[model samples]
Target: MVGRKILDDKHGGKKHLYALNVQYARSEFLKRDDQVLAIRLQQEERLNARKKAAVDIDRARAQAGQDGEPYAEPDPDLDEDVPMDDIAGDNFGSKTIVIHVGSQNLRLGLATDALPKTVPMVIAKKAQRSEADDSEPRPKRIKLDDHAPSEEWFGDEFAKEYIAMAQDFKVSRRANKRRVLPNSRELVTKWNSTTPPETIPEHSDPLRIDWTELPANEKAAPDYIVGAAALRIPERSRPRYHLYWPVRHGWLNEKDYAGRNMLERDFFLILEDSIKHELGLTHRREWSQYSCVFVIPDLYEKVMVGMVLQEFLRDFGFQRVCFIQESLAATFGAGFGIACIVDIGAQKTSISCVEDGMIMEESRINMKYGGYDVTETFVKMMLFDRFHYADFNLMRRHDFLLAEELKGGFTTMSDENISVQMYDFHLRAHGQNTRKYTFKIYDEGVLAPMGYFRPAIFDHSDKLSGRHHLIPRSTDLYNGHPNDPLSKAQMAVISYVNQAIPSAVTAPSAQPVRPLATPVAPTPTKNRPLGIPSHLNGDNDPTPRSSPAASPPPDDGGTPHPTGDDLNGDEIGELKGAQPDTEIIDRTVPVMPLEQAILTSIHHASGMDERKRRDLLGSIMLIGGASKTPYLGQYLEMKLRAALPQYPKEILVAPPPRELDPAVLVWKGGSVFGKLRMTNDSWISPLEYDRLGSRILHYKCIWHW
Candidate 1:
C-alpha cells in the first residue's frame, strides 16, 4: 500500500516520472459518467509503455552483441595505464568565466585565473538636473565645535538622566546589569572636541580627484561611479548623485516597492559595468568569447534567476551560462563532499546542507540578518553609554562607514576577559578631512557580536517601533510567464470513477487482498498505446500542448454522483471543489540564533538518512564575513554538541580550508567548479536558452532544483 517513486538524480530529472494512476486510489463503490473512456485510455498508455520498454531492451541487446568485449582476451597488464591526449570530461573550457555577486561585493574572473578580482557591490549614478540642482557638501559633524556648551547626551530628558546616573552609579561588573555602561576612565576618544581639517597631499592620492569635495574647478561630475569610489562620494554631493545596493537580504531589493523595470535595469547595469571595469572586458565582442558560471544563492527566487539569465544570454552576449548554488560551490571550493555550509553576508544569513554536491531542499534557510545587523547593534550599544557622536545615523554615508570600520576592527567573539580601556580610530569620512575621535567601550565590543546569538538586542534598535520589511514581491514569473495553465475543461483528467455500484452494499467490511498477477484478455487496440488520447494517436501528430491541470470530478462519496436522489430534507451540502491558493513569498526576518538555525536546518533535511545526518553534524562548515568573528566556529561547535548529546561523531566547525577568508570561499568554489570536466555538458548556451526559455534550467541543472 505504501510505495515511493524517487526521481532519478543523474540526469537532473530530465526523464519524467509519471504520477501514480489516481484510479488505483479511488473507492470502488462510487461511479462517474466517463469512467469507461478513462479506463480504456489508461490501459492503452500502460500497453504502449510496455512496448517501448521491450523495444529499448532489444536495441540494447543488439548493440551489446555487435560491440562485444573491449579486449580479445584477458591480459596480465590490465593494471597498466592507457595514455590519452584529451579527456571528454575535462574542464568546461578555457574561456569559462566565474561570477559571484553578493550584497556587499562581486567576485569575477576567468576559471584559469588563480584569484578572482573582488569589487564592491555598489553603484552611484549622477542625478538628472531636475534632481541634482542646489546640492552642497555635508558640514563638519565630528563633535561639538565649542567645548562644554550643550548637554552631554543627545536623547530625551529621561534618557539623559538614566545615562548620567548609570555612569556614576558604580554598578558592579559581576552583576552584569541590564543598564550596561562604561566606566569614567581617562577618555581616549575625545568628547566635546571637534576635529581639525587636514589637507590631502599629492602623490598619495590614488584617484587624485579630491573625493572629499568634488573638483573645485570642474563644472560637473561623471555620469557614474561604482565600487569603493561610490561610497567616497560625500553627503553634500549626494543631491547630485544617488547610490543603489541592488541586492539586500539575499534577493532583489524591493521588487514591489521599486518597479520591475528599475530592478531589471539596476541589476543588469551594475553587473555589466562592474565586470567591464574590473575585468577590462568592456565590449560586447569581448564578452561573447567567454562562458559564464554564475554562482547564485542557495535559497533564491526562481524568477530572479530567470531574469538574471535572460539578461546574460539574451542581452549581455555571453557565449554560454550555467548556475550553481552557493552552498554546493562553497563545498567544491573547500574540497568537502558532505557538510553544512553557513553563509553570513552583509545583510543575510543562509544555511544549507550539501551532501555529495546536492543541496537538500529542506535544509535551506535564508534569514534576513547578518554583518550589517551587528554593526547596527554596535551603534545602539555605543549610544547607550553617551557616545561622543550621539547624533549618528546609518542613512548618512560617512556615519555608516565609521560604524562599519568600528565593527570590523573592534567587535570580537572571544571571551578572554578583555580589560576595559579607551581606544580611538581615525575617521576618514567621504569628502571630509581626516578626523580622530575617541571613546571608551567596556563589554560593548564583545556583546555587540553576541547579538548574533541573542537577536533581542535588535528589537529596540530601529525606532520604527517594530521590525522593518526589506524586499517586496510584486511579480514572479518563474515559469516563463504568469498566464494561467490550460483551462481545466481542456485538461480534463482521465476519469477514475467506477460505472458499476452494488446498490445494497453494507456500510463497511474488511476488504479481501487482491492477487498481484490478475491477467486480462488481449484488447483490439494493441498497436495504440494505453493512455494515448484519440487526438494524439495519429502517425504525424504535430500539435503542441501546454502544461496541464486536471478538472476535478464531482463528488463521488458522502453522496454518490450517479445516485443524485434528493435526500429527505436532511443533507444540504457536500465537499467538492477546493478553493484556489493565494500567492506566497519566501521571506522571514531573523529571530533564531546561528546555532539553532544550523542545527534545525540539518535536522530538517528531507530524505537524508541517519548516517548522512550524522556526517553533516560532524562536518558543519561556517563561511561568511560575520562567521569570521574570532573563535566563533569553536563557539558554534560547542553549542551544537551541547544540544545533541547522543550524536557519536565529534561535531566540528571548520572555517574555509587553509584559513581562507569565508567571504570569498564560495566564489573560489565557483572558479574551481567551472574548471571541472563533469560540468561541460551542463553549460546552457544562447541557442538552448532561446529555444527553451527558462524551462531549460529544469533539464540542464546538475541537481533537481
Candidate 2:
C-alpha cells in the first residue's frame, strides 16, 4: 500500500493518467451550512467513539487478568524492501552514462544508477611564489622525457595540500613569536648594563607578516585545483591563487582561454575518474564502450555551442552522445509532460514552458537573478546596516559564507526580526589580535530571497520604468481620437466603403473607364522575366494605380473572367494593402522583473492559443537550489494567479520535492531517460555525426529547434 501511494504520487495516479470522464468541478462543500454543521457533528461523534472504545478495551483487559502478550501496532515507519514487482525493471547490462554539467555542479553516473555523483564546477590555481624564491633549492623533478613536466593537482587533493600548507604557516608563526619575546628581553638587560638605560634602543614591534604570501614550495610553481578543493582555499590566500569557473550563467565563458582550458581539463579528469570509480574499470579501452548523455541549459540551443560541446565530448572518446535541455529534463524527471519550469540556478534563473515534450523556445526567459544574487544582496544589506567600518573587499568571502548559512537558518523561521551571530577574524583591529565579530541580520534575510518573486523591491531605480512596447499608445490608429488625422483618414475610408456598397447596387449604367494607351513600350531589358521591360515589370513603374477595379455587372459577377496579368496585379495590390504600418521596437530594452519576465516568456511561445496558454499558466514547476527559498512556490503561484485571474482554480505551483535535492533533478531525469530503449534514436554516434555534421542534433534533440 505504501509503495502504491509513492508510485501514485510520483506518477500522477493511474486514474489521473487513464480516466476518460474527468470533470471540472468548482463546488464549495464547506460553504454549505448544513454540510458544515454535519461535518462538525461527525468529527465530535468520532472523537467520542474513540474514547469509548479505549475505555471498553481497558475494561476487557482488566477482566482477563493479564494478557499473554500485548498487542503491538505494526511499525508503519519501519524500513521494508520493496518487492521486485513494485520496482521498475532494471536493465543494467546496457552501457549508457548520463552527465549533467550545471553552473554550480557536475553530476555523472551510469543509466542504471538511481543518482549521480556530483562535484563543484570550479577550478583554482595554486598560489605561485615570488621571483625572489627562485634561488632556493627545488624539489627533484621526476623526468618522464627530455625534461620533466610540471606537476599539477586537481579536485580534493589540491585543496588538502593548500590547507596543510596554511596550517604549517600558522604553527611556525606562533613559534617565531615565542622566540622573539625572550630574545628582546635579554637584549634590553644587556643594553641596561653596558650603556645608560635611557640610551637603550627601543624594542621594535614584531614585524607584521602576510601569511598568505608565504611560499608553499621552494620553486614558484603554480598548479590548477578543481571542484570542492578550490573552495577550501584560505580567505587570505585566495588573492594569490586565480580562481576559474568554466561555466557561468549556464554557458561556457568564451573570453578567458586559460580559465576555459582549465575547466575543460578538469571536466575531462572528472569524467575519466567517475567512469573508473562507478564502473570499476581501470583500462582506458573500457571507456570506449559506453554512451554519454549531457543535460545542458536551453540557451545553448540558440547557437553552434551545442555542436561545439558535442565535438568536445567526441574528443573524449565517448562512443555516442545525446543532449537534453535542463528544463525539459527536470520536467521529465518529475514525471510531467506540460509544465512551466522556473530553474533558479547559482548565477541565473531560467523560466521555460514545455508541453508534450516540446519546449516553447520563444517563451523562455533567462535572467541574472539567482542564488548568488541573493547572497550578494544579503552581504550588501549587512554592510549597509552594521559593518560600515570593515573593508568590503577583504570581508566579502567570509561574509558570503556567513550569509549563506544565515539564509538557510532564517528561511525556516517565521519571525520578522531574526538575529544571526556571524564570526569573522578579518574584523580584528591588528594582525596580532585574533578577534571575532558578530553580525546580526534582520528583515533583509527574508527580503533577499523574496526578491526572486517581487523583484521590483530589489530592482534598480532606472529599471523600474514600466515602459512596455506592447501596450498600445494613443498614437496608434485604433486608439486615436475621432478628430485626429490618422483616425479621420480611417473614418473616411470606412465611409467610402459604406457608400461604395449602395452606389454599386443602385447606380444607373456607367461608361467603362478606358485603360491608358499602353505607355510607350520602354526598350526591352535583357534577363527580365518574360522579356518584359524592367520599368513595366513593377520595379520602376512610373504611374501608380490607386483605384479599385469597377465591380462586375450583377449578371457577370459570378463568372467574371480576368486576364492572368490582371489577377496578378490585383493580388499584389491586396497584399500591400493588408500590411500594417506599425514601427518595430528596438531590442535593447532593459531587463524586466521576475514576474514580468515569466509572463512575457509565456506570451511569446508559439502555437499557444487561449486554451494552451491557460493550461501552461496552470502548471508552473519551480526547481533548482535557489528555488528552495521558503514560500517561493507559494509566492509565485499567488503572483501568477493574480496575473491571470481568469484561469481555473486547478492551477498549481509544484515545488521541488522535499525528499530529493532539486539541483540534481536534471541528472536524475537524464538517468531515467538514458535507460530507455527508445532513447537509442536520440544518441548521435561519432560516425553519424562525422557523416552528417552538427545538423543532426536539430532533429535528435527535441529542444534544439
Candidate 3:
C-alpha cells in the first residue's frame, strides 16, 4: 500500500509541472507588454530633456553675451568684495595692510578681508644671464634709487618654479638612462640656470652632448639659482649660491650682513608687489594712503625692532607703520583676554602668559624645540634605526620634505604601522635598482613630536635644573656678586633687630603713666592737620591719625600688612628692620620640560595670586603649526591638569575658532586689530618715527610700553 501511494504522488507532481510549463509558454506568446514600452519611452524622454537643457543653457549664454552682460560665474571661495575690488574703491580709510612675518611663512592681507594671504617667507635671487649670453640686450630694470635694481623672486612663485625644475631634473635622468619615466609634460630647458634641461636624446643621436665634457665657461652659474632653486643644484655648485634666511627663530638673523640684506630686499619687494601689482597702485604717491601693521615675535630685541622700523620708514616710505606682538595679537585673534599662549613655530616654541590684553614679560619662555626638530628627530630615527641607511650624505632636501609629509600623514592616522614608499631614496644595499623602497615606520614616526613635550628625549649636555630664565643676562639676579649691598643691608637690619629685641624686653619704659597728659594736647602732623576738628573726622578716614602713635598691631598670622608709601618714617624703619637677612637662593632651573616650562611661566606671572594663576590656566591657547599635531592640545591639557591637580579637573583649553587657522592666528588678530577704529592710536606714523626716532615704538606699542 505504501509503494502504491508513493507512485501516485510522483505521478501528480509530474503532471503539475507540465501544466505550469504550458501556462508560461502561453503567456509569452500572448502579446507585447506595455510595461516594457513605458520604460523605453521614459529613457528616451530623459535623453531628450538633457539635450534640451544643454541647448537652452547655450542659448541663454549667447543671449546674455549679445545683451553685453556676459554671465559671470560666482566664486565659492571669495566673499562679495575681494581685497582687489575693495582697493579699487575710494573707501581706503577703513582698510589696513596687515603683515605677519614668520620664520617659515609670510601672511599678508587687508583688514577688511576674511582671511590673509600666505606666502613663503623666502626670497630667491633671479637667475642671472651667463657671460656667454652677454651679447643679448638686457631688459630695462625697475629702479628704486640711483643704483640699479637687483633682480629677485619672492614667495610661492619662486618655490613653484624651483620645485618644478627639480622634479624635471629628476625625471630627465631616468628618461636618459632608458628607465621608466614619470608622466610629466614635455621638458623645455631655459638658459642661464633658470629652467630644467631639455630631454636628453639617445646616446646614438647626434644632439646628445655629454654634460661631463662641458667647459667651465659653458656651465650654469651656481649663484644664479636662489631660494628653492638652490636645493636642486649639485652639492659642489651650492657654495657659489647664497641661500639667505632673513629670519630665524622669529627674529632678524643678525648673525651676518647677508641675512639682513636679504630681509630688507625681500620686504621691499613684497611691499612693491602688493602695492604695484596686487592692489594696482603703480605710482609711488599712492603709498601714503595706506597704513601698514607688522606682526613680530614677542621676544624680539629692541635693535631688531628699530631696524625693521627704519627700513619701512626709509625704504618703503609707508605713511604709518605699527608693530604688534605675535602672542598678544594671537590672543586677540582667538578672542580671549587672559590666556597662556603656546606658539609652536617651525624652529622654536614660545610660551607666554597674557593677562587682560597685556603680556606678562616675566612669564615668557622661548625654546629651540618645534616642528623642525621633530622632523629632524624622525629622520634620524628612520636613518639609524628603521632603514639603517649608512649613506646620510645621499639624503637630499626632498627626502626631508618627504619625511615631513610622512610625519604629517602619520599624525592623522591611528594605525601603529605606517608604510611609506620613498621613491627618491637610493638604498646602497639595493645597488642601482630603480625600484622604490617601502619602509614600515612604526613608533619612531608617530612619536617623533614627543621630544617637544619631553626634552630629555633629545641630547642636551647642560641639564636644566629649575625654571628657565628668559630675562637678559645683564639684569639677572645672579649676574652680580652674591654679597652685594642689598644683601649687606638685609644683614644690617637683622643684626639691628637682634640687638634691639633683647633690650626692648629688659629696658623700663620712661614716663609710663602719662596717658592723660597726651590726651590733653595731641600734636598734629602734616598728613593730619589740627585745623580739622575730631568731630569732622567721619567713619572713613584714609589719612593716618595725628595723635601719638599707639602700640604696633598684634600679628594674627593672616594676611601680610599692606606695604604702601603712607607708612610714617618710623614705622617704615621698624618694618624694614623686621625683615630677615636670608639670601634669595637662586633656585630657578634652566631648560625645563615643555609642561614645566608652561607651568613655571604661569607660576611666575601669577606670583602669589592664586586667582590670577587659575584664570590663566583655565584658558590655555595653543597656536602655531606645531599645535596642529594630532592630540597635541588634548595631551597638553591632560599633562597640565595632571601637574595642577589642585585646580578644577575641567580646565578649558580653548583652541582657535573653527574657521580660523592656528598657524596664522596672529595674522588674523593683526587683521582684526587693523580694521577696528579703536586701534588707530596703535598706528605709528612715519613723521612721528622720524621726529622721535625708533624710540617712538616703545610708547606707541602698548605691549612694549
Candidate 4:
C-alpha cells in the first residue's frame, strides 16, 4: 500500500497512468478523439509489402515441403492440452482436493470423497540433548503462582493453574462489559475454588513412564512424530522431543526456538507429512494430478495465504488452488442464505456473519480461548476435590490427552445437572503396562463447561504472572507497532537505506545520491497526490501539481515513454517513510463474550442489505468443535435473546441441515463449493500466481479477504 501511494504521487494521480494499465484508459478515450482512432486504425496496415513481385523466384514454393506448409512446424505457441477457458483450471471436479486447515486439525480429501481425513495440526521434533542436561526453555512451562500465602487470593491465580493444563496455548479472553440483569454475571466472590490450580502436581517419577518394560529397539525415537500419532506417543518418550503446533489457536504458532522464519517450514512440514502419509500421495508427481481447494480463516493474514498458495501450487506440485473462508463455506454446506457462524475450534474460537456466500469482513473475529479452555477448566475443577490420579501433569502428553478425552466424554452444559458419578479408565502407554483406575466426579463436569459463560473463573491475565513474557502474544504481518519485529518488506527498506547512512553522516558529497541508497526525505507538498501527512490527510486535500500531456500507451511488447515525475528525474530520495497500517481493524484484539460477539456481528452487517439483518440475526449457526457441546447453543440463545429483546419471539440457533455434523460442516461446504460450476473461474494455477503474485487472491478468492 505504501509503495503504491509513493508511485501514484510521482505519476499522474491515477493508477490508470501505469505503463501496464494505461492502454485501457487510452482505448476509452479513443472514441473521444476520432482523428486518433482513425490514425490508430490506419497505422494497423500490413507490415510486409502487399503481393511480392514475380522476380522473387519460387522462394515460397521452395520453402514448402511436399506436405503443404511443412506441417506448420507444430505451432510452438499452442497452449497445453488442458482447457484454458474452463474455470477449474487444468483439473476436473473429481480430481479436485478440498483441504480444510483448522487450528487443531487438518482435513483433506478429494472433493468427490465422502469424508475428509482429520489429522492433528501438531508435530513433535526430535530434541537435541546437551551435555549439561539443561532444561529446554518452554516459555510455556507452568510455574507456581506468585501470590503469597498472606496476600488475598486472585482468580487469575486459579485461571493460571487451569490454563497451565494446556501450556502450549495462552488464553486471553475478553469478557463483554455490557450491561446485564442484576446479578446475572458469574463472579468468584470468596475464592470458593477449594484448591487453586497454582502449583504443578507432584509428578509420579517426573513423568510416570514405568521405563523398566521397554525393549532396546523401541528406545530409539524417530526424527519426528506427526498428527494423531504425535499425541499418542509413549508418555515417557515425549520429553525427548520438542512439540510444535503450527497453526495453534487459529494463528501461525510462533516459537522462540524455531524463530519466526521457521513458521512456514513447520507449517509446510505438517501439511507435507499429512499429504504424504495420510493421503498416500507419496510421490510429488502424483500431486500434479490433483487441484486443491484450501479453506482459510475468515480473519487471515495475506502473507499466510501467500505462503499456503506457494506451498500447494509451487512447492507441493498441485495443479491449481482456491481459498474459501470458513464462515462462507459453512453457509454453503448448510444451504443458508444468511447466518451468523460461530466456529469454536480446539484452542481458538471465531464468529462471523455470512450473507449469501460471502463472509462480512467487519463482522468476523478470532478469539484465543476455545473448547480446549473448557478441557483445562474441567481438569482444574476435578483437582479441587480430594481425587485419585493426583499426579496429573499436563506437561506430559498422556495427562494432556486424558484431559482432552475427559472433556469430550463428560463435560456438558445442560441445565439438568447430574450428581457426582463414578467413572473408570485405563491409562495405556506404548511398551508399558496398562493400569486401570476408578474416580468419582461431582458437578465439576457441568460447572467446568459453564466457564465459557463465566470468564472470571479461568480468563484472567493481570495476576497470571509470566503469561505475557513467557508465552508472548504471537505476532504476524499485522500488529504494526515498533515492539513487533519488521517483516521482509520493512527490513529490505531499512537495509537499502542503511547503505547510504554513512555517506549522509559524512560531508555533503558532490555526487548525487539515489532513492533509498541515500537517506533523505524529499519534503512533500500538500498539493501533491499522496503527499499529505496521514494525520492531516482528512483536513488537507491532495491535488496533483501538474497534468502533463498524454503520451502513447505501452505497446504489446510493453515499451513505454516515462512520465515527467518518474524516478528517472535528477532528484529522487527517500528515508523510511510511514508504511500503511491496518490498525483500525481490530481482529480478535479482545476475546469478546459469545453473546456480545453475536450482537456486534449482527449490528455490523455492512456487506448484507439492511433488510437481511433480521434473518441473519435469527438464523445463527454454531459450528466447530466447541459448538458440539450440549446446551451451549441453548445458553447462547438465552444470552442473545436477552441482548436482542426486540428480535422475533426467539433467537433461533439452527443446526446443520439434514442432520449434518456441525464440526465438519465447513469442510462439507468447501466440497459443495468445489462442485459448483461458477467456482471454475476461481481456481488459481501456478502460472497465474507467478504473473499476478499474491494479489491474485483479490480476483480469485470468493470473499473480500
Best by lDDT: 1
Q: How far is candidate 2 from the true structure (C-alpha RMSD, Å)?
A: 27.8
Model 3 agreement with the true structure over 63-170: per-residue lDDT tens digits: 888999968542222112222332113344345678877666667777766776665554434334321122211111122232421222112332243344335434
lDDT of candidate 2 over 532-564, digit per residue (tens): 112212222222111112111122122211111
**Which is the leading candidate under TM-score?**
1
Each prediction's total of clashing residue pairs, residues at least 3 apart in sequence or on different chains, is 12, 0, 2, 1
> TM-score for every candidate vs. truth?
0.63, 0.53, 0.53, 0.62
lDDT per model vs. reference? 0.57, 0.47, 0.48, 0.54
For residue 422, give model 1's deviation from the true position in Å. 0.7
Error of 3 at 307 (Å): 0.9
- Screening candidate 3 with a backbone cut-off below 3 angstroms (N, C-alpha, C), the clashing residue pairs are 466-589, 467-589
Task: For candidate 4, list the clashing residue pairs, or say none.
Answer: 87-680
Instruction: Give per-residue CA lDDT, model 1, range 83-122, as digits (tens).
Output: 2111222344367788898877778887777778887777
Q: What is the TM-score of candidate 1?
A: 0.63
Ordered list by lDDT, greatest first: 1, 4, 3, 2
For candidate 1, the 10 contiguous residues with the lowest summed lDDT are: 491-500
| Reference-based lDDT, residue 54, model 2 | 66
Residue 604 accuracy (lDDT) in model 3: 49
